[model samples]
Target: MLFTSIKPMLVASGDEAFDDDDYLFEPKWDGGRILLHKQGERIEAYTRDGQLVTAKFPELKEVAKSIKAYAVILDCEGIVLRGGRPVFDDFAYRGRISLSAKIKQAVLTHPAVFVAFDILLAEKECWNEPLSERKKRLSAIVDTSSSLMATMSVEGKGTILASLMKERNMEGIVAKRKNSKYIQDTVSPDWLKIKHDKTIDVMILGYREEPFSLIIGLNFRTVKNKPVGLVSDGFSQADKDLILSLSKELHTVKEVKTQWIRPELCCRIDYRDRTDTHQLRMTVFRGLLRDKRSEECVWES
Candidate 1:
């Protein structure tokens, strides 16, 4: 069956992990989402956004041999693992190469692995089937190997799995309802992402008025204040007003688009992780810190 015209199911965010007898929890691999289609020997891969990435990740060409079925479509995440954990920056770098020689060399140096989580088709339509049955079928057909592996899952213990994956610095865990049918091209509530809670304290550097965002930086005693990233989320109207009042009192003439502040105010930030350039990813302003001093918000490592 051709899955090129279809999109992978999307997930909604969950606040915290919990135990649920009706849901299955699986590790959320830190990598690009891909859907693979196998028709006899011909194998094709597409991104969640419908971008054809088969030519980019040449190592995935062997996926057909790892599957027992002659025709099947699988939903997976393509990741490059190091030390048994996914290094997302390395996987992202592999996606950006254009030259054929570099691509071949990267395949040898840093190969991609597809972790199958769900099966859409196996000689018949399986999208309408319950997730639990589809998972069973996926495990039966997909061989676990270095290049292609079926995703491992734990039933009714999302909290435990989430904690373990967090300790390993893995992305997070996804909680899928066991009886939920696969819904294509939609962010279904049947699936939820329970991410690890990570936070940091940073000094507020400035603010931009148009989009209403804060320019945050990490204070350092030995070095100059480092521009970590911008934070525009998780702010209430009251929080915005407080920042506006503070900016007026601490405003400086050294402004360049952003209204520069005294850099004395400190606040706690929630983030997913750091990007390749060391900037915070998916930052959210938790709240202002009254007890902590700006100087104390120094870089940890």
Candidate 2:
């Protein structure tokens, strides 16, 4: 039997972190979510969006060989790390390289590590089992010492872990109910993600008139600065007035109908993470950063 894809359980976002004895907290890896299927000598990997990405990550084929089960479905994150920290840029770069020869070369140059967090199926369906039991079965099946490693979780320490992740510049920590059973394609409160606040100073590049949004761009030292996304929320009326005034002074006719401004003006933005296409996700304009410069609005890895 061959399995093409398995809908993975989703996590709900939380505003803050709290301690709970019935929950387990793990580091939220900043990478692509993937499901791996192995049966006999056949191996396949799919992204969260149900795209077949097996050809892109040829190195993960080694992961299938490590499993002793006749058939298994593993839930994991395809993460590329730099100096022990998960780097989304590296994962994005690898995902974009489509040529077979380049993908093979990229596997050697920038290999991705699979962080297995759950076992949806092994020998038989295990989604009905409690999370704790599923984790034990996952541990027994996966070789943690290889590129594929089991994700470690801490009980009753979500608050502390969230603080540490913030201090370490990590994305966030996910809290999972210990006794909750996996629910495919569902967004349940059983899994909650508490992301640390990430604020970046970006240049105000343009604006949309209809929705009244500000287009923001980040200056890269080597790469050309481009508009990442638009922010229309998290601003007061006074702030909007100030932006309007500033736009009038800096606006240029680079594009028709759109108000393009010089990149000298910068503002602070808060966001959860970047989308697969490198656009900002859940972004909101905090306020204008009067003290910052456009050249200083570089993205931090």
Candidate 3:
């Protein structure tokens, strides 16, 4: 009886805002969302979509050992941070079902940690309590060494935490409204997420389609000029619609089969990565940049 994928909320800025005593805020992690299931000594963890992923992260099991409440579930963000920066390689390895020992070794190199922000259960008591109260119970979970373990995140000021995000090139910040009641079935403008602005132009050399879904061709920037990585995500609905129409206009390049564009329309993309290879690990489309000349579309080499 746990809420799995509720519509997320946002926090808005108001006059003398987030300035109440009953409010609690936490640093938004830029990692995979997790739902911890601990029902009657039946301990398991799942993704936001109810995908089982408990044994994948042994470090999380370390924290699981301390949970005293049975028949309870917790909503949290599982992060893997090293040297004060979020490391995504851990998740990448865990994702491979037939994980090799080397992959597991890499996981230890970058230990995954949980940052529980809310408790949906509290000792047979519905933790549908206020955000402030749920956070208190979650913080008391023992046997964890993660950084966000001790207290509710620094209150109400995203500017400072945003600086940390920017410093680490972290994805963005999610602001949750203070005193927002926890609801398994609700949607509101009770949370706000802000991300860093970034975009680059890439040659869409090809397009592939299944029953539904467009596969875009992405050319990587190379120092000596050789396309290395291929990126397919980061297209918006409008972009997809536009590209579907343009597919009739452009010929698919045979060698790469990447649908080529006029290179006139550039997209402003915001993304995150760990390697200097400059490949975006996760990217979301921002908008089309009409003015940036294709010559200026060049990225850092």
Candidate 4:
């Protein structure tokens, strides 16, 4: 069977990690999701959105030799690790470059490794099979010593694994139902991402006029108050109106379309993690904090 375009099964956000006998837990490696389609000596890599990135990562060509099966489709996360932890920033840099010269240089400096978590197709159709069965087949055929390797999974210890990931400052843990079948392109509840929940108090530096967003910043000892980024998510309609109307009175400066504020108002922001450049990742406004002072929102070293 020939595999054309394949979308990886999506995982839904889980609030907290818990232990369950029916679930298998694994570290949710921070990187881009890639589907490896191997047929004979040829192997093609596709992004989660079904974009072919086979030529971009020349290191993936070595994956063909790692698979023991003649034909298979492997769901994997392509990552660049730093000190044994997957760093998305390095992987993103590796994935974005288009020039052959730059890519060749990056391949040497920031080499990527494919961590296969699930087997979609091996020898025959395995997507319909239970996850536990597929995992067994995946371990049997994949050469872990090579550039590609099977992702390690723990049984009935999600909360324990989540705590370990947090201690290592890693991405998070994923809990998957052992009996679940691979459901492509759909966000399945059978798979859940339990990320490390982190929140920070930031000062509202400014506001964007259209579509409505708050420019937030933290008061660093060196850099007083520098704008980190804009956040629009987790705001209600009333919250939007309150900020837009209040911005006119607190207006300090106007640059382009952004209305700068006095940096008096402070609010809390929920974020997944900080990027390599120190920008917040996956930010959500948790509402205004009236008791806290803007000066108190310091970015601690």
Candidate 5:
């Protein structure tokens, strides 16, 4: 319930309405959107759009067991860290590597780090004081230098922090306002993300609402099967409004009688891998594909 995706805008320097100095800028890791919850070793992972993900990441269960808390909810991005750098595609490859000694060897060789950005619940209590305050509690819990998941935090200079957050081979950065809180509605400029350069075309599977997230189900021309993955980030208010307007003309969120227009709009997403089922793994929406079509895309040669 803590993870949400809206559009991103570059924070301008010296804007009176914005506090550039107070904001925390961190590199956005291109990885699977995950929610970590703990209730006395009863831990599990959930996708950004609220799909259960515990079985997919069995290794994490042990670590999740170590942390003893009544209930702690964290907003984090989970990905395999290879050579101190995160390989965003590992989530897709998990199925292939299941139960393989070599798989754990490789993943441990290049482990996955959990970059937690917010502390929604702490000490069996709601840490809803303020985003700035909640982060302090979250930071105190994870030590990036020694945690199994490569947990990290920025200190001394955030500019330096921003630099460390970068993995030249991975995704981009996500900048957030320290003073912000979890707001259910849009127009909150407290967080923004910048991502990598790989883009792909996809179709709208539908939407999932907690904070009104976009769930992009993947499909390409000439291949007919279940989608590969779901995209949960890189959308803004205008973008959501636009989607709502367009989708309403065809379908309603509550109604299945909707008609989704094909090819009128296309989206370019960034991903690190593909599911055997043909879905985008660890992806985000770059924006609408203004000059492309859904049918024009060919992934299966």
Candidate 6:
């Protein structure tokens, strides 16, 4: 079966974790979500956004040889580990390298490990099967010793695992219902992601008036400061007014309606993680850091 493009099931973000024997908890790997399609010696890999990334990570092509099935589709997270800890930035860096020589060098320098967490299809379609049955089938097909490995999951103890992840400064933990069936292209609550919120101080670079939003940027010394994203949420009227007043004094004309301000004001923002392009995700304006300087807002990770 030639699978051109298939969207994987998505997980909904959860506020807190709970213990449920009917659910399974797995480490939420901070890396790119990929779907691997294997047929005999041939293999193909696609990102969550449907980008053909098989050529990006040449080492993963060997994963096709590890699968016993004649044809199969595996859902996995592509991660690069450093000192036994998953380094998402390294994995993300691998995805961006364009040259073959550069990619090959990166492969040896920062090798990626494919953590197969779900089996969408093996020999035949298995998406309709319950997660428990699918997991069994997945475990039977893939060789655990290979670079393509199965994700370690616990029967219950979501709370415990989440706590451990936080303590270790790992990404977070995912809780999935054992009986839930894989629903393609859907953000299902059956799979919940409890990510540890990361807070960073960013300089307020610009602002918009109509809807009321502030453009934030990371402060780096070597490179030019770039916009991370906008933050309109988690701000009160007073905050907006204070920001607008400050903007009037510091604002410089950049775009027609957009006003660019001096990167003098800094505020703390709570975000999940950086996007593939290094932009902040799930960003919310926490509050102003009155004493902090814009130059003090350096990139965390």
Looking at candidate 3, the ten consecutive residues that score lowest on lDDT are 8-17
lDDT of each structure?
A: 0.86, 0.85, 0.54, 0.87, 0.55, 0.86
TM-score of each: 0.76, 0.85, 0.60, 0.76, 0.51, 0.81
List where candidate 2 sits over 4 angstroms from the true fold: 207-213, 220-223, 231-247, 254-258, 281-293
Per-residue C-alpha lDDT of model 2 across residues 1-301, encoded as one tens digit per residue: 2476667889998878999999999999998898988888888888887889888988777887777688889999988888778888888778889999999898877888899999988989999999999989998998864578888889988999998888888899999999999998999899998887688889898887766888899866566567888888898879888888888888776665578887878999899877655578788888898988888888767
The order of the candidates by TM-score, greatest first, is: 2, 6, 1, 4, 3, 5
Clashing pairs in 4: none
The regions of model 4 sitting more than 4 angstroms off are: 1-3, 199-204, 207-214, 217-251, 254-270, 273-301
Instruction: Give the range of the ten consecutive residues with the poorest summed lDDT in model 6.
Output: 217-226
Clashes of each: 0, 0, 16, 0, 14, 0
Cα lDDT for residue 18, model 5? 18
TM-score of 2: 0.85
User: With candidate 6 superimposed using the best TM-score fit, by how many Å does residue 57's alpha carbon deviate from the native?
Assistant: 1.6
lDDT of 6 by residue, 172-204 (tens): 999999999999899999999998877888999
Error of 4 at 187 (Å): 0.9
The predicted structure with the larger lDDT, 1 or 2, is 1
Per-residue lDDT, model 2, residue 289, is: 89
lDDT of 4 by residue, 262-285 (tens): 988888988886755557777899
Q: Model 3, 189: alpha-carbon shift in Å?
A: 1.7
Find the candidate with the highest TM-score and give its number. Answer: 2
Question: How far in Å is the alpha carbon of 117 misplaced in model 1?
Answer: 0.5
